[model samples]
Target: MSDFRADTVSGKLTTFMHRARAEGVAEPVRHEAKRLILNQLKASVGATGQQAVRLMLDWAMAEAQGGGGAHVHWFGTSLPPALAAMVNGALYEVLDFHDTYIPCFMHAVSGVLPAVFAEAEAGGHSGTAVVDALAIGLEVELAVATMLMPTGYYRGMVPAGLTGGVGAAAACALLRGLDASQTQHALGLAMCTPAGIYEAAGSHTLAWITGNAARTGLQAAALASRGFTAPPTAFEGDQGMFKTHSDEDRAKIDGILASLGTEWRIFGQTYKVVPTETITHGPVECALAILPRAGGRVVERIDIKVQEIVVTIVDGRRERFGRPSSTPQATFDLCHCVAAAWLRGQFTTAETSAPCYTDAEVIALSDRIKLTADPGRPTFEGCTMTVTFADGSSESHNVDYFLGTPNARVPDSTLIDLLEQYGAGVLPAGRAHAIADAVLTLDTAPDIHGLIRLLNKD
Candidate 1:
């Protein structure tokens, strides 16, 4: 069963799986996985009340009450494994507050957790097993995403849709106890299913893509277990994934496959402080730094100079910058995000709502927001923000790295508090901490029963 041809992407992924399964996870790696898991669950719990999330949950609850399949966490409903992953995956991304792998601009944990947890819970996998699956799955997800990004992102491809299912498939195959060959086939099938377009981010189509990637992963793995076959050269062939999405130099990607499992890509994931796009993080930091001087002032002009790609994606919905109609739209409008935060002297999830997006004062300020992209600026981690008041006084700040990025990491305590804060609002009393505890201690624990199973005992 070990017929690894190093030139093929499937072979490379197979070797990655073999090494991980044989070696298990190191302590630090497992801890990182726990941190990623807790953060994703936090995002899922916080977004449970979103209109889109509620709509999906209402649809899933119909079949989940019977308890013969995987249970959808945060909703107390059970559905088939694939469907469970689909619903949970949508919740993970509907909020856009989850972790983003900065290199690829993808929410690294969103799609993978849904598939990993759904399969783990359905298969009665232990906490250790779940953590292993998550680490491996997220690692692969970020890897493929790295191989496609910058070029793929600029090509109008959604990074999460392109890599989420592939990561999920790798994890699901592990849970289903498939061989490396079967795992590669699952990866190939998963590779064939990435269809999300970057143009649909603020619309409902993003939720569909996120959910479909999660659903496809579980289904792909199940199909692979039944002798399903896929192209072995699906990743780096002449017309493979690499060629289809990106025009990056082939030399940079030539040795990429052999590099798997050496240094995990899971470490590249960035946690968000506010529920806005990652591109807004540094600019928001720059905005907040100068807000004390510019607060309560009538704006003559607001300018943020950032990398060109930031403008392409974060400010992609330029028309909605001053007239956002929904939460999703508000989260993507860099102009609105800074203007509203400038007016309020702070930015929080509240800014991503109707009251903030439609506020007359916020609109007046956002309408003056001018996002200038500097083509020479190539980094995603820095930006310059300038605010000019009607009095002709201007305040400016330059940020090198925002908190929550790899260089400037949000503390683990802050992330734990994020989850606990959700308990006070959305989840049941203490459910948030309970989930946090389960994730934090997962590697040494017995099982994931506390995470996905519904316990009725008083």
Candidate 2:
């Protein structure tokens, strides 16, 4: 056994992650990585004109000190690799429509792909290289999340922000071709910068946290490449990351490292079919299913039973759920999402923002929705919606798996259609289709620069 096996949790993880990055991953892993990258790019394009994305891009560009190395998606400008990663990472998440890992409730693509694309573009890496780095990064991130589960969120930490830096740093290190020790240093540096609180949800600061993770990861890798040192046992000591962020007595380091590269966690990731919270997707689907039976009748009441975790995260704040003033707030409000779906028969970006948010019908229906915790329902993977019509008739639907869950992967044709639907008006004519075609065949592309070029508006 390696010395790291008996040393500490961080040591073992660092060693395992370095080894995993060095080895060749499966073709499916690479394909999934490409899909995740494409998904994030699509989301970035869709959010190109959003106020949050515009503000953050401007802030990132202003902070650039002339060391332009990489491009920001859809912005048509180059910035320092770290700054570019920050801007693009935040853009990937501005719509809240990125790929998520169900187990960790972390948006894996938003956390890792921004840094991977930035570093790959800066170094003139190939498309295959980008996929490889992303796969490795996601593996490291999911492992970290799996080990720290049930506590990270309970402690009010945002999963993406809490674990994103390490994932992004791992991808950066791989793209830079760092060895085990250097990768360890990169992870240690990343651990020092973990941030994002649950309280930041429903605010512009949420996107800022996502961007900070990408920037911090790139900076950590850059520093580590120059022989910067960090404590080896950064995750298991008394004052380590795991101890500080989680209530666990000791890190589940060995268990997390044991399955690295063997069981690909990337395969279990879920893509978002809508621009809303993952937990709300199932409930929205349930409401949509019941919409057809209502026949345009007034909804007298809506009774929703969901897992306790869902209530805690999405419906915990009565005032916010009752009346959402902002897009972010509406996205997290289950009642709002279900109500919108019931009224419109679909929940999209349009429903989460503006006139739709303040629509009288949506507000009236949302107020009638009563959310209750179901102790028997262990996971947010499913929810049941009961709609009581004014005529004293009721309809109920239960959704065990939403469209993009691992058990119910979105069909490629449907996903492509959604890409076009979401990208309409945002991307120039035919631009979205061309980008999708390139991403579908990303492995054959000579370089990622050609792909990045497609993202820029002419």
Q: All candidates' TM-scores?
A: 0.93, 0.95
lDDT of 1 at 62: 75
Model 2, 232-266: lDDT tens digits are: 77776667788888875453667668888789999
Q: List the candidate 1 regions with Cα displacement exceeding 4 Å.
A: 1-7, 62-68, 295-297, 314-316, 320-322, 453-458
Question: Model 1 reaches what TM-score against the true structure?
Answer: 0.93
Clashes of each: 1, 0
Worst 10 residues of 1 by lDDT: 449-458
- Model 2: CA > 4 A from native: 1-6, 65-67, 249-251, 319-322
What does the lDDT come to for candidate 1? Answer: 0.80
Q: How much is the lDDT of residue 135 in candidate 2?
A: 88
Per-residue lDDT tens digits for candidate 1, residues 1-458, read 55436557777887788689789888788888999988887676677678887787777767556544676667667788888898888988887888988777778788888998888888888888888888988888877887788788888888888989999999999888898778888999988778788778777678778888998988899999998988888888787888897777767664666577778777877898777878888888888888777657867888888888777665447743436888988888887888888888788778888989989998887878777887767677888888888888899888777888888888778887887665456566766666667678887767787766422111
* Each prediction's whole-model lDDT (CA): 0.80, 0.81
